[model samples]
Target: METTLTLKDVTITYDKKPALEQVSLSFPKNRITAVIGPSGCGKTTLLRAMNRMLEEEPGAAVEGQILLNGDDVQKLPPEELRRRVGLVFQTPAPFPFSIYKNMTFALRYYGVQNKERLDAVVREKLTLAGLYEEVKDRLDKSALKLSGGQQQRLCI
Candidate 1:
């Protein structure tokens, strides 16, 4: 019933060249939307700008506003903002840790220390990512042992 994300008059520039221009959109909570365009059409740029990831680039600059849950993400602390608008890249990047550890790592980083809570969250997120069934019994196995597709799904 509420908007989860909003981008208004958003623009991003790299080395004085525009990557995104005057883009505005809103994403409703629990709905799915896709961005379709030719390569280099600013789809990735627009996505990166949403969480202020564009600020990491040497020559990248962003203008206008990106709101997450009614808060301007650009005005929030980077670490806190990233937790709310996580990005999963097209390619999979499983950490060198065990399958269970991979999911637990993020939970730990967010200061989740209860064993029961960690177990529940790991299974819940893995299931939501469509990966729990495949890796459920091998929670201790190294994530890299899985096939590329499986690994990518796990990373999701």
Candidate 2:
């Protein structure tokens, strides 16, 4: 099987303390790979490091290489890298905006300005996340008004 992401000798530290040390992993393309561990293990850290989110954490340090399709993640722009490597948080995090706006925020930031296209993309994404039918009529309502499960689905 082909690999989609690879981590080689990757280590992560926070405030001079290590969270992950010399870890290596590869996720196969089109395959489900689970990183199972006890709570507080480096699973989240490992995932964040893959897309360079680790760099956002204060005092966090990463070493070694993280490659996506053999391309170094460090070589890619943070926005482009994040677009390719999405990480859904364990908790729901809806933006403080309408459901439609929440869905279109990234699209707009990426220069999608056509209203029809934005609507279509919002509908498509909500549908894919199984949220369209639940909140389709309330697209202009605040996303935070949705139930926790609904908000999580929207986040996904």
Candidate 3:
């Protein structure tokens, strides 16, 4: 069996302050795992490092290997790695646009532009995120108008 994600002796530092230290873990393809810790215990830092999102933060640095399906994700393009390992933030960060536009933005950013295909993808993702029924009739409405939970689902 292959692992879906693996972190080997991973460490992250911010402004010379250590956020994560010497952590190793493996997530098997069909299994689920959770990280439970107090605040500032590096849970988010470790998660960000796995997908290399920490690289975007100022003065943030990571050490060691983050492998996705046997390939080093650090060696892959950030955009490509992000596609395979999407992250949903703790808070909703919807775009300042309509409900339809919110999903369309992700599709367009990934170079998906066909109308029918994009619509299908949006609907599919929204349905998977459990927001389809709530916004089915108002896809043209502003995403900001939604409740916090709904907006978070839209972002998912």
Candidate 4:
């Protein structure tokens, strides 16, 4: 099996305190993998480090090689890497916008301007996240109006 993501000796630290110490992992392509652990076990930290979002923290540091399809994640532009690798936050965070707007915001940012394409992408993503059937008739409503579970799915 081919691995789509590989972490070699990855260590994450916050203000010199190690959150994740010398961890190595690999995720196989096309497979659904879960990071199972109790609370405060660095599961979210490990995930944030994968896509370089950990760097946003004031004192966070990551040392090691994170490769996405054999390319160093550090070498890739942050936006481009994030476009390729997305992270759904553990807490549901929907933008203060309509569900349709939330769905198309990134697509528009990436220059997908055609109405047909935007509509199709939104439908496809919502369907994949199992949210389309529930929210299809309410896409114009505020995303914040959704239930916690529904909001999280919309975040996908």
Best by TM-score: 2
**Candidate 1 Cα misplacement greater than 4 A, ranges:** none
Task: At residue 31, give the lDDT of candidate 3.
Answer: 83
Candidates' TM-scores? Answer: 0.87, 0.94, 0.91, 0.93
Supply candidate 4's per-residue lDDT for 154.
Answer: 92
**1-30 in candidate 1: lDDT tens per residue?**
689998899888999898888888899999
Q: Candidate 2: lDDT of 114?
A: 100
Off by over 4 Å in 3: none
Candidates' C-alpha lDDT: 0.88, 0.93, 0.88, 0.93
Q: By descending TM-score, how would the candidates be arranged?
A: 2, 4, 3, 1
| Candidate achieving the largest lDDT | 4
How high is the lDDT of residue 78 in model 4? 94
lDDT of 2 by residue, 13-99 (tens): 999899999998889999988998999998999999988998888899999999999999999999989989988877889999999
* Overall local distance difference test of candidate 3: 0.88
TM-score, cand. 3: 0.91
In candidate 2, residue 57 scores what lDDT?
A: 86
RMSD of each: 2.0, 1.2, 1.5, 1.3
As for model 4, its CA RMSD to the true structure in angstroms is 1.3
Q: Against the hidden true structure, what lDDT does model 4 obtain?
A: 0.93
